[model samples]
Target: MADLRPQAMIFVTEYIRNGNNATQAAIAAGYSERTASSQGSRLLKSVEVQQFLNKTEQNLNKDLRVMFADHAVNAFNVLLEVMNDPEAQHKDKLVAARDLLDRAGYKPTDKVVADVNTEGTIQIVFSDKMKKADSS
Candidate 1:
Protein backbone atom coordinates (compact mmCIF):
# COMPACT_ATOMS: atom_id res chain seq x y z
CA MET A 1 0.00 0.00 0.00
CA ALA A 2 1.02 3.60 -0.54
CA ASP A 3 2.47 5.63 2.34
CA LEU A 4 -0.11 8.30 3.01
CA ARG A 5 0.52 10.82 5.75
CA PRO A 6 -2.16 11.73 8.26
CA GLN A 7 -1.85 15.37 7.33
CA ALA A 8 -2.90 14.44 3.78
CA MET A 9 -5.77 12.34 5.07
CA ILE A 10 -7.02 15.20 7.27
CA PHE A 11 -7.07 17.41 4.24
CA VAL A 12 -9.31 14.83 2.59
CA THR A 13 -11.49 14.47 5.67
CA GLU A 14 -12.06 18.20 6.06
CA TYR A 15 -12.86 18.47 2.38
CA ILE A 16 -15.41 15.70 2.73
CA ARG A 17 -16.87 16.99 5.97
CA ASN A 18 -17.20 20.49 4.65
CA GLY A 19 -18.58 19.19 1.34
CA ASN A 20 -16.20 21.56 -0.35
CA ASN A 21 -14.37 21.47 -3.64
CA ALA A 22 -11.13 19.68 -4.38
CA THR A 23 -9.38 22.98 -4.87
CA GLN A 24 -8.91 23.32 -1.11
CA ALA A 25 -7.51 19.86 -0.56
CA ALA A 26 -5.50 20.00 -3.75
CA ILE A 27 -3.92 23.19 -2.53
CA ALA A 28 -3.34 21.60 0.84
CA ALA A 29 -1.59 18.39 -0.19
CA GLY A 30 0.77 19.65 -2.89
CA TYR A 31 -1.15 18.86 -6.08
CA SER A 32 -2.09 20.91 -9.13
CA GLU A 33 -5.40 22.35 -10.26
CA ARG A 34 -5.52 19.95 -13.16
CA THR A 35 -5.34 16.96 -10.84
CA ALA A 36 -6.62 18.17 -7.49
CA SER A 37 -10.18 16.94 -7.81
CA SER A 38 -9.22 13.52 -8.99
CA GLN A 39 -6.64 13.24 -6.24
CA GLY A 40 -9.13 14.35 -3.62
CA SER A 41 -11.55 11.70 -4.79
CA ARG A 42 -8.85 9.07 -4.51
CA LEU A 43 -7.89 10.19 -1.00
CA LEU A 44 -11.48 10.48 0.17
CA LYS A 45 -12.10 6.88 -0.71
CA SER A 46 -8.83 5.65 0.71
CA VAL A 47 -8.96 2.98 3.44
CA GLU A 48 -6.61 4.99 5.69
CA VAL A 49 -9.11 7.83 6.02
CA GLN A 50 -10.68 6.59 9.26
CA GLN A 51 -7.39 5.93 10.98
CA PHE A 52 -6.16 9.50 10.63
CA LEU A 53 -8.91 12.08 10.22
CA ASN A 54 -9.54 13.05 13.85
CA LYS A 55 -5.94 13.25 14.92
CA THR A 56 -4.75 15.17 11.90
CA GLU A 57 -7.60 17.62 12.14
CA GLN A 58 -6.71 18.25 15.77
CA ASN A 59 -3.04 18.70 14.94
CA LEU A 60 -3.43 21.12 12.04
CA ASN A 61 -2.52 24.67 13.02
CA LYS A 62 -2.74 28.11 11.44
CA ASP A 63 0.78 27.66 10.10
CA LEU A 64 -0.50 24.75 8.04
CA ARG A 65 -1.55 27.07 5.24
CA VAL A 66 1.89 28.55 4.97
CA MET A 67 3.58 25.15 5.30
CA PHE A 68 1.33 23.68 2.62
CA ALA A 69 2.11 26.46 0.19
CA ASP A 70 5.77 25.69 0.69
CA HIS A 71 5.20 21.98 0.14
CA ALA A 72 3.36 22.48 -3.16
CA VAL A 73 5.81 24.97 -4.54
CA ASN A 74 8.74 22.83 -3.46
CA ALA A 75 7.13 19.71 -4.91
CA PHE A 76 6.60 21.36 -8.28
CA ASN A 77 10.13 22.69 -8.18
CA VAL A 78 11.28 19.07 -8.32
CA LEU A 79 8.53 17.73 -10.55
CA LEU A 80 10.92 16.51 -13.23
CA GLU A 81 12.81 14.35 -10.75
CA VAL A 82 9.58 13.18 -9.18
CA MET A 83 8.16 12.07 -12.50
CA ASN A 84 11.27 10.07 -13.35
CA ASP A 85 11.78 8.65 -9.84
CA PRO A 86 9.64 7.96 -6.78
CA GLU A 87 12.40 8.08 -4.13
CA ALA A 88 12.83 11.78 -4.69
CA GLN A 89 9.54 12.62 -2.99
CA HIS A 90 10.88 12.01 0.52
CA LYS A 91 13.85 14.23 -0.15
CA ASP A 92 11.52 16.82 -1.56
CA LYS A 93 9.39 16.78 1.58
CA LEU A 94 12.38 17.02 3.86
CA VAL A 95 13.78 19.93 1.90
CA ALA A 96 10.38 21.54 1.83
CA ALA A 97 10.04 21.27 5.62
CA ARG A 98 13.54 22.56 6.19
CA ASP A 99 12.88 25.45 3.85
CA LEU A 100 9.61 26.23 5.55
CA LEU A 101 11.25 26.23 8.96
CA ASP A 102 14.09 28.36 7.71
CA ARG A 103 11.74 30.89 6.11
CA ALA A 104 9.78 31.13 9.36
CA GLY A 105 12.98 31.47 11.40
CA TYR A 106 12.30 28.26 13.33
CA LYS A 107 15.35 26.15 14.01
CA PRO A 108 14.68 22.52 14.84
CA THR A 109 18.16 21.72 16.08
CA ASP A 110 17.86 24.19 18.98
CA LYS A 111 15.01 22.19 20.39
CA VAL A 112 15.66 18.95 22.23
CA VAL A 113 15.90 15.89 20.06
CA ALA A 114 14.02 13.45 22.23
CA ASP A 115 15.21 9.90 22.06
CA VAL A 116 12.81 7.23 20.97
CA ASN A 117 12.72 3.55 21.82
CA THR A 118 12.74 0.75 19.23
CA GLU A 119 9.02 1.36 18.76
CA GLY A 120 9.70 4.88 17.39
CA THR A 121 7.76 6.77 20.06
CA ILE A 122 9.66 9.85 21.18
CA GLN A 123 10.57 10.19 24.85
CA ILE A 124 10.71 13.85 25.81
CA VAL A 125 12.66 15.24 28.79
CA PHE A 126 11.80 18.52 30.44
CA SER A 127 14.19 21.24 31.56
CA ASP A 128 14.30 22.78 35.06
CA LYS A 129 12.67 26.09 34.22
CA MET A 130 9.83 24.18 32.61
CA LYS A 131 8.90 22.72 36.00
CA LYS A 132 7.33 24.15 39.20
CA ALA A 133 8.66 23.40 42.70
CA ASP A 134 12.17 24.18 43.98
CA SER A 135 14.74 21.44 44.26
CA SER A 136 15.47 19.98 47.77
Candidate 2:
Protein backbone atom coordinates (compact mmCIF):
# COMPACT_ATOMS: atom_id res chain seq x y z
CA MET A 1 0.00 0.00 0.00
CA ALA A 2 2.97 2.28 0.55
CA ASP A 3 4.57 1.62 -2.81
CA LEU A 4 6.00 4.77 -4.35
CA ARG A 5 4.14 6.41 -7.23
CA PRO A 6 4.91 9.13 -9.77
CA GLN A 7 4.70 12.76 -8.57
CA ALA A 8 1.50 13.39 -10.53
CA MET A 9 -0.10 10.34 -8.98
CA ILE A 10 0.99 11.52 -5.56
CA PHE A 11 -0.52 14.91 -6.29
CA VAL A 12 -3.73 13.23 -7.40
CA THR A 13 -3.88 11.22 -4.18
CA GLU A 14 -3.72 14.37 -2.08
CA TYR A 15 -6.35 16.04 -4.22
CA ILE A 16 -8.67 13.04 -3.82
CA ARG A 17 -8.24 13.10 -0.04
CA ASN A 18 -9.08 16.78 0.09
CA GLY A 19 -12.12 16.74 -2.17
CA ASN A 20 -13.02 13.03 -2.44
CA ASN A 21 -13.58 13.70 -6.14
CA ALA A 22 -11.57 11.79 -8.74
CA THR A 23 -12.24 14.08 -11.70
CA GLN A 24 -11.18 17.15 -9.77
CA ALA A 25 -8.14 15.28 -8.48
CA ALA A 26 -7.15 14.35 -12.02
CA ILE A 27 -7.45 17.94 -13.16
CA ALA A 28 -5.52 19.17 -10.13
CA ALA A 29 -2.84 16.60 -10.87
CA GLY A 30 -2.31 18.35 -14.25
CA TYR A 31 -4.23 15.97 -16.47
CA SER A 32 -6.21 17.39 -19.37
CA GLU A 33 -9.46 18.89 -18.06
CA ARG A 34 -11.35 17.65 -21.12
CA THR A 35 -10.44 14.07 -20.34
CA ALA A 36 -10.43 14.42 -16.57
CA SER A 37 -13.57 12.37 -15.91
CA SER A 38 -12.46 9.32 -17.87
CA GLN A 39 -8.85 9.63 -16.71
CA GLY A 40 -9.93 10.06 -13.13
CA SER A 41 -12.19 7.04 -13.26
CA ARG A 42 -9.34 5.01 -14.71
CA LEU A 43 -6.85 6.27 -12.13
CA LEU A 44 -9.25 5.52 -9.29
CA LYS A 45 -9.48 1.92 -10.44
CA SER A 46 -5.69 1.50 -10.53
CA VAL A 47 -4.35 -0.94 -7.95
CA GLU A 48 -1.49 1.28 -6.86
CA VAL A 49 -3.73 4.34 -6.51
CA GLN A 50 -6.32 2.40 -4.54
CA GLN A 51 -3.66 1.03 -2.22
CA PHE A 52 -2.21 4.48 -1.62
CA LEU A 53 -5.60 5.98 -0.83
CA ASN A 54 -6.66 3.06 1.37
CA LYS A 55 -3.37 3.09 3.28
CA THR A 56 -3.58 6.85 3.74
CA GLU A 57 -7.10 6.57 5.12
CA GLN A 58 -6.14 3.68 7.40
CA ASN A 59 -3.18 5.60 8.76
CA LEU A 60 -5.26 8.70 9.32
CA ASN A 61 -7.94 6.75 11.19
CA LYS A 62 -5.27 5.08 13.32
CA ASP A 63 -3.88 8.48 14.24
CA LEU A 64 -7.32 9.88 15.04
CA ARG A 65 -8.47 7.30 17.60
CA VAL A 66 -8.78 9.75 20.46
CA MET A 67 -10.60 12.28 18.26
CA PHE A 68 -12.98 9.59 17.07
CA ALA A 69 -13.66 8.45 20.61
CA ASP A 70 -14.48 11.95 21.74
CA HIS A 71 -16.77 12.51 18.81
CA ALA A 72 -18.60 9.24 19.42
CA VAL A 73 -19.18 10.05 23.08
CA ASN A 74 -20.32 13.58 22.27
CA ALA A 75 -22.69 12.30 19.61
CA PHE A 76 -24.24 9.74 21.96
CA ASN A 77 -24.61 12.32 24.67
CA VAL A 78 -26.41 14.61 22.24
CA LEU A 79 -28.68 11.80 21.23
CA LEU A 80 -29.54 11.05 24.84
CA GLU A 81 -30.22 14.71 25.51
CA VAL A 82 -32.52 14.89 22.57
CA MET A 83 -34.33 11.74 23.58
CA ASN A 84 -34.92 12.99 27.12
CA ASP A 85 -35.84 16.57 26.32
CA PRO A 86 -39.60 16.98 26.29
CA GLU A 87 -39.25 20.36 24.56
CA ALA A 88 -37.39 18.76 21.64
CA GLN A 89 -39.19 18.19 18.37
CA HIS A 90 -41.09 14.91 18.25
CA LYS A 91 -39.24 13.83 15.11
CA ASP A 92 -35.87 14.60 16.68
CA LYS A 93 -36.72 12.69 19.84
CA LEU A 94 -37.95 9.75 17.78
CA VAL A 95 -34.72 9.74 15.80
CA ALA A 96 -32.68 9.81 18.98
CA ALA A 97 -34.71 6.99 20.51
CA ARG A 98 -34.32 4.94 17.36
CA ASP A 99 -30.58 5.51 17.35
CA LEU A 100 -30.29 4.53 20.99
CA LEU A 101 -32.31 1.40 20.42
CA ASP A 102 -30.20 0.53 17.39
CA ARG A 103 -27.00 0.97 19.40
CA ALA A 104 -28.43 -1.31 22.08
CA GLY A 105 -28.88 -4.10 19.51
CA TYR A 106 -32.65 -3.80 19.47
CA LYS A 107 -34.14 -4.47 16.05
CA PRO A 108 -37.64 -4.81 14.69
CA THR A 109 -36.76 -8.28 13.43
CA ASP A 110 -35.64 -9.54 16.86
CA LYS A 111 -37.67 -12.71 17.26
CA VAL A 112 -39.00 -15.13 19.80
CA VAL A 113 -40.10 -18.65 18.97
CA ALA A 114 -42.27 -21.08 20.89
CA ASP A 115 -44.08 -24.33 20.23
CA VAL A 116 -47.82 -24.12 20.77
CA ASN A 117 -48.47 -27.80 19.95
CA THR A 118 -46.84 -31.18 20.65
CA GLU A 119 -46.36 -31.64 16.93
CA GLY A 120 -43.32 -29.92 15.38
CA THR A 121 -45.49 -28.47 12.64
CA ILE A 122 -46.94 -25.74 14.87
CA GLN A 123 -44.76 -22.78 15.76
CA ILE A 124 -45.37 -19.35 17.29
CA VAL A 125 -43.20 -16.34 16.59
CA PHE A 126 -43.16 -12.76 17.74
CA SER A 127 -41.08 -9.87 16.38
CA ASP A 128 -39.52 -7.16 18.54
CA LYS A 129 -42.00 -4.77 16.96
CA MET A 130 -44.46 -5.26 14.17
CA LYS A 131 -43.14 -2.21 12.33
CA LYS A 132 -39.91 -2.61 10.41
CA ALA A 133 -37.69 0.40 10.01
CA ASP A 134 -36.91 1.55 6.50
CA SER A 135 -33.23 0.83 5.88
CA SER A 136 -32.94 3.61 3.35
Candidate 3:
Protein backbone atom coordinates (compact mmCIF):
# COMPACT_ATOMS: atom_id res chain seq x y z
CA MET A 1 0.00 0.00 0.00
CA ALA A 2 1.14 3.53 -0.74
CA ASP A 3 1.98 5.89 2.10
CA LEU A 4 -1.12 7.66 3.39
CA ARG A 5 -1.32 11.12 4.88
CA PRO A 6 -1.93 11.36 8.63
CA GLN A 7 -5.52 12.54 8.03
CA ALA A 8 -6.15 9.70 5.61
CA MET A 9 -4.84 7.18 8.16
CA ILE A 10 -7.06 8.71 10.81
CA PHE A 11 -9.97 8.53 8.41
CA VAL A 12 -9.33 4.84 7.80
CA THR A 13 -9.14 4.06 11.51
CA GLU A 14 -12.25 6.03 12.27
CA TYR A 15 -14.05 4.49 9.32
CA ILE A 16 -13.68 1.01 10.78
CA ARG A 17 -14.29 2.09 14.37
CA ASN A 18 -17.41 3.91 13.26
CA GLY A 19 -18.82 0.86 11.53
CA ASN A 20 -18.03 1.96 7.98
CA ASN A 21 -19.76 5.30 8.32
CA ALA A 22 -17.59 7.08 5.80
CA THR A 23 -19.06 10.51 6.26
CA GLN A 24 -18.79 10.33 10.04
CA ALA A 25 -15.24 9.02 9.78
CA ALA A 26 -14.22 11.84 7.49
CA ILE A 27 -15.66 14.46 9.79
CA ALA A 28 -13.98 12.81 12.79
CA ALA A 29 -10.72 12.87 10.85
CA GLY A 30 -11.01 16.66 10.41
CA TYR A 31 -12.59 16.86 6.96
CA SER A 32 -15.14 19.65 6.64
CA GLU A 33 -18.73 18.48 7.10
CA ARG A 34 -19.68 20.04 3.74
CA THR A 35 -17.20 17.84 1.84
CA ALA A 36 -16.79 14.91 4.21
CA SER A 37 -19.24 12.71 2.37
CA SER A 38 -17.60 13.27 -1.00
CA GLN A 39 -14.11 13.00 0.47
CA GLY A 40 -15.01 9.75 2.19
CA SER A 41 -16.44 8.34 -1.03
CA ARG A 42 -13.33 9.36 -2.96
CA LEU A 43 -10.98 7.89 -0.34
CA LEU A 44 -12.90 4.61 -0.31
CA LYS A 45 -12.40 4.42 -4.10
CA SER A 46 -8.61 4.80 -3.84
CA VAL A 47 -6.68 1.58 -4.52
CA GLU A 48 -4.30 2.20 -1.63
CA VAL A 49 -7.15 3.00 0.74
CA GLN A 50 -9.03 -0.14 -0.27
CA GLN A 51 -5.94 -2.28 0.25
CA PHE A 52 -5.36 -0.76 3.67
CA LEU A 53 -8.97 -1.35 4.66
CA ASN A 54 -8.91 -4.98 3.52
CA LYS A 55 -5.64 -5.66 5.34
CA THR A 56 -7.02 -4.03 8.46
CA GLU A 57 -10.15 -6.14 8.28
CA GLN A 58 -8.13 -9.34 7.83
CA ASN A 59 -5.98 -8.48 10.84
CA LEU A 60 -9.08 -7.75 12.93
CA ASN A 61 -10.55 -11.13 11.99
CA LYS A 62 -7.32 -12.88 12.93
CA ASP A 63 -7.30 -11.12 16.27
CA LEU A 64 -10.91 -12.07 16.88
CA ARG A 65 -10.20 -15.75 16.16
CA VAL A 66 -7.30 -15.71 18.56
CA MET A 67 -9.45 -14.03 21.19
CA PHE A 68 -12.21 -16.59 20.77
CA ALA A 69 -9.79 -19.52 21.01
CA ASP A 70 -8.27 -18.06 24.12
CA HIS A 71 -11.66 -17.84 25.81
CA ALA A 72 -13.14 -21.10 24.51
CA VAL A 73 -11.52 -23.29 27.16
CA ASN A 74 -12.80 -21.11 29.98
CA ALA A 75 -16.23 -20.95 28.34
CA PHE A 76 -16.41 -24.73 28.10
CA ASN A 77 -15.31 -25.12 31.70
CA VAL A 78 -18.05 -22.73 32.81
CA LEU A 79 -20.61 -24.69 30.86
CA LEU A 80 -19.47 -27.95 32.46
CA GLU A 81 -19.60 -26.44 35.93
CA VAL A 82 -23.13 -25.27 35.33
CA MET A 83 -24.15 -28.62 33.94
CA ASN A 84 -22.69 -30.55 36.88
CA ASP A 85 -23.76 -28.28 39.71
CA PRO A 86 -26.60 -29.83 41.71
CA GLU A 87 -27.57 -26.41 43.06
CA ALA A 88 -27.94 -24.94 39.61
CA GLN A 89 -31.48 -24.39 38.38
CA HIS A 90 -32.69 -27.27 36.23
CA LYS A 91 -33.48 -24.99 33.33
CA ASP A 92 -30.06 -23.36 33.54
CA LYS A 93 -28.35 -26.70 33.69
CA LEU A 94 -30.31 -27.93 30.73
CA VAL A 95 -29.40 -24.79 28.78
CA ALA A 96 -25.71 -25.21 29.60
CA ALA A 97 -25.80 -28.88 28.60
CA ARG A 98 -27.44 -27.99 25.34
CA ASP A 99 -24.86 -25.28 24.66
CA LEU A 100 -22.01 -27.70 25.37
CA LEU A 101 -23.53 -30.34 23.12
CA ASP A 102 -24.05 -27.74 20.38
CA ARG A 103 -20.45 -26.53 20.63
CA ALA A 104 -19.26 -30.12 20.56
CA GLY A 105 -21.03 -30.69 17.23
CA TYR A 106 -23.86 -32.83 18.56
CA LYS A 107 -26.68 -30.49 17.66
CA PRO A 108 -30.11 -32.01 17.08
CA THR A 109 -30.97 -32.91 13.53
CA ASP A 110 -33.16 -30.50 11.59
CA LYS A 111 -36.32 -31.84 10.03
CA VAL A 112 -37.35 -30.55 6.63
CA VAL A 113 -40.96 -30.66 5.49
CA ALA A 114 -41.92 -30.61 1.86
CA ASP A 115 -45.39 -30.36 0.32
CA VAL A 116 -45.91 -32.16 -3.02
CA ASN A 117 -48.76 -31.08 -5.24
CA THR A 118 -48.02 -32.95 -8.46
CA GLU A 119 -48.59 -36.57 -9.46
CA GLY A 120 -46.45 -38.31 -12.03
CA THR A 121 -46.09 -41.84 -13.41
CA ILE A 122 -42.73 -43.58 -13.04
CA GLN A 123 -41.31 -45.70 -15.90
CA ILE A 124 -38.06 -47.51 -16.55
CA VAL A 125 -36.53 -48.22 -19.96
CA PHE A 126 -33.52 -50.34 -20.85
CA SER A 127 -31.35 -49.46 -23.83
CA ASP A 128 -30.07 -52.07 -26.30
CA LYS A 129 -26.54 -51.63 -24.87
CA MET A 130 -27.84 -52.39 -21.36
CA LYS A 131 -29.72 -55.47 -22.59
CA LYS A 132 -26.62 -56.76 -24.39
CA ALA A 133 -24.48 -56.14 -21.30
CA ASP A 134 -27.00 -57.96 -19.12
CA SER A 135 -26.96 -60.99 -21.48
CA SER A 136 -23.18 -61.00 -21.49
**Please, what is the TM-score per model?**
0.30, 0.46, 0.76
Question: On a 0 to 1 TM-score scale, where does candidate 2 land against the true structure?
Answer: 0.46
Instruction: Residues 15-66, candidate 2: write the lDDT tens digits.
Output: 6576778777877778788998887788788888777777777777887997
Worst 10 residues of 1 by lDDT: 127-136
Tens digits of lDDT, candidate 3, 1-136:
7687888888899999999999999999999999999999999998888888889899999999999999999999999999999999978998899899999999965423334334754445566666677799
* lDDT value, residue 65 of candidate 2: 95
lDDT score, candidate 1, position 71: 88
Candidate 3 residue pairs in backbone clash: none
Report the number of clashing residue pairs per model: 0, 0, 0
- Ten-residue region with minimum lDDT total, candidate 2: 127-136
Tens-digit lDDT string for candidate 1 (8-125): 7657665756656656776676777788788777776767754455455656654687789888876655654544565566666556666656666887643343676889898886
Query: Which is the better candidate, 2 or 3, if ranked by TM-score?
Result: 3
Model 2 regions more than 4 Å off: 1-6, 14-24, 31-50, 60-69, 86-95, 110-136
